[model samples]
Target: MEQTIPPAESSIVEFKREWTETARETFCAFLNSHGGRVYFGVSDDSSIVGIDKPDEISRTVHSIFKFAIHPSAESYVQTETLKIKDKNVVMVTVLEGSEPPYYVTIKDNNKKGRVCYIRQGSSSYEANDKEIRSLYRKGNPIPYEQRASANQNLTFLTLAEYFKKSNVQFNEGKYQTLGLKDLNGFFTNVGLWLSDQCTAETRVGFFLGNTKASESDGIFTFSGCIIEQFCKIRDLLRNRFGFKNKIEPYTLSSEGYRNEIADYPELAIREALINLFAHRDYSFENAQATVTSFSNRLEFLSFGGLPQGVTKEMMLLGISIPRNKTLADILMRLSAMERYGIGIPTIFASYENFSVKPALVCAHEYIKLDLPRLQQIPSDLTERERAIVSYLKQNGASSRKQLQDFVKVSYGTVINTLRSLEAKKIVVKQGAGRDTKYALTISLR
Candidate 1:
């Protein structure tokens, strides 16, 4: 009897005379695109070439799916035996994978590489970046932080130390749990952010006036481990914008008190900083988070505007859909942030008693939080009253003679300014006779 002939090769069916390493590429291609079948022991020209060891071929095919395809494509594939022309052959069928694009690992010249394959016509071809992105968009969209990084050789010493301080286990065994590595044991993009050799840039700029064009008082660039960068940025902000202590002398019936007032509420600043780090889009390599300090306000800007299905109103209402889930998870585990999605609300609430409200502006590519500085001194105060208030803010309580020396005015001019401030209840007169001094009564609220 003439041997049974297989159908001609097509997009949905492939034939191989024998098992070869390239077979794994075709398997990946099938899984990434539409499902297809590969018939081992069959010639490309639809001729049956029976397998010498059917059982062995089946076992080898199973092994190839197990170790060669990324993200475990074996679950979507199956292998069996068929008898054609009274001879046995191996048949491998791959179903379209739900999560793609699947990649196959190749080894050549003592080096290993990964390539995503897609079925084009009747052949498998390496997918370009655009094709891969389309596949991701069609399937479950993969978070950039969850994708494997190009640099496989990575070290997480900084991350390990951070976890150690937090008493969280961060050894090799917990890499998958922490999202440092994928199922295939490759370093992921999240791991790159936490690595000691991270190259992502984050910047903080202090302008002399109120805009970017103004002379930069200072600029700080942060790189490497993200945790360390957070700490450093926090410290820098604290030093530049922290609160100052103002003493209120005792009155006839009330005891003396001290108040700590800051340019911007410290809690609001911290929440904005944490939100900037947690929700930023890591996929935009050129974009970065920036803290621009102006004379009257501080602006926190980060790339990758609000997440999908989230809006500025939703954020104000305490709704959060994190752009980078793994990064946010790690931050939550470290206790650096809470999962309640209240960071923005907390920032707004911090300024509820203040005259100026915090503003949130979202655009296509970036989001910004503007925090207005505390202005306890009345905006309508006279120039001399403003001068006196500024002087007292810097020098604390001051005698009339000292105020005169500081403001470069006569004692009478100083006394008139002080009396006007006192009349407005913006200044408090302390002590008696020559020991008298004036202090600001500007309430923090």
Candidate 2:
């Protein structure tokens, strides 16, 4: 939906003009601040003038942003047609730039020839020297994870139950002892060590074994830098592997019949999760872990693309290099993991037991584990069986030919499937010879 603008400027910086210097200044201001949207064909007073020639207007706006603006920026423009007073209004939408400090030439000006303009509140103004310095500083802003927030309100009690479950001692005075500077510093201050505040230098956090954070945090979001890495790995796993599964429990039994594949292996799932927790370079200063479930497979992701000197060939051969010694030792003590150095091998073994091969993916920013689906019975059979059961409950009986036609399977396949049903005590035959039919013997939930 198009954002409706009033005939004039509001508190928010929105570009709403047919064509004017003010519109160019507003667009640049929004880019410099929180990226926002600009809509043309609306009066400064917020009336809908609508672009007369949307294509031409679009071309003009693109040229302006591309050629006229200094410190070139990227933006999106969409021309939408709407009905107002039984006439079409062409709406020009401009997305705010990802990078900041965008400006345009104050065309034909008497003063301030090459001055850069920025958004200060609702109005546009020439960026002062201090404002310009601030923008430059923001150009390479500090990552979210490295900076301390005075508002987190976090304490050791935030994850106290986790520590209790692990039987690890959580010294309450550790915060002040380490000179962590605050009760609610960062997970890196307690558990996983990441980069120091502002600089790229890596340092270990206070809590080593994650007595205070969940697997999700240690693997995904301990620090903002690592969290971003987790997101990258997740994307690669989704785009490349295309597997789907759930984070849950399952039991396999061989008492029924042959040829049934287990949904997943217990050992494989644990090893995958543990490998992500144990081996990832949590101090890479800009990486994380990600876990995703899909319809056919499950993905475990690690940050920092692959490791600095590791490749896909090295991974396949069960090569393991421990990244976090302190945290790893603590995990071993808590019995959450082991020192096998064969985590990958264990995961592969689990897949082989389930008659499936999991995929390993390496990208520029992440390493991914992809577990494929195991085929036991046909996927469509569940739906077909459901339809047959409902039909039998309503119609009392069904002939093999009728069932085949209804379910769209071969006659022999339907006969065999029905025979298996009888063996399961779900249905039984009635009548004799050509007059034979099938009826539900007992309802199975």
Using TM-score as the measure, which candidate wins? 1
Model 2 CA lDDT for position 295? 30
Off by over 4 Å in 1: 1-140, 243-260, 376-445
For residues 112-170, write the lDDT of model 2, one tens digit per residue.
45556676566767787556645654664542223344333444443334346678665
For candidate 1, lDDT tens digit of each residue in 1-445? Answer: 5434447988889988987878877898999889999998898888887788878877877776788777776788788888888777788889999988788887654436888899988999889866785687567666778889988888888888889999998888988888889998889998998888777878999764556765465688999988878877876776555343222221111322223356788889888988888888776677778999865689999987888789999999998888878888888888888875899999999999978999999997799999987854455666566666666754568888888986788878888888888888888999999999988785722
Q: Which ten residues in a row have the lowest lDDT in candidate 1?
A: 246-255
- The alpha-carbon lDDT assigned to residue 65 of candidate 1 equals 75
Backbone collision count in every prediction?
A: 0, 18
lDDT of 2 at 212: 26
Off by over 4 Å in 2: 1-152, 173-262, 278-296, 322-330, 352-354, 375-445
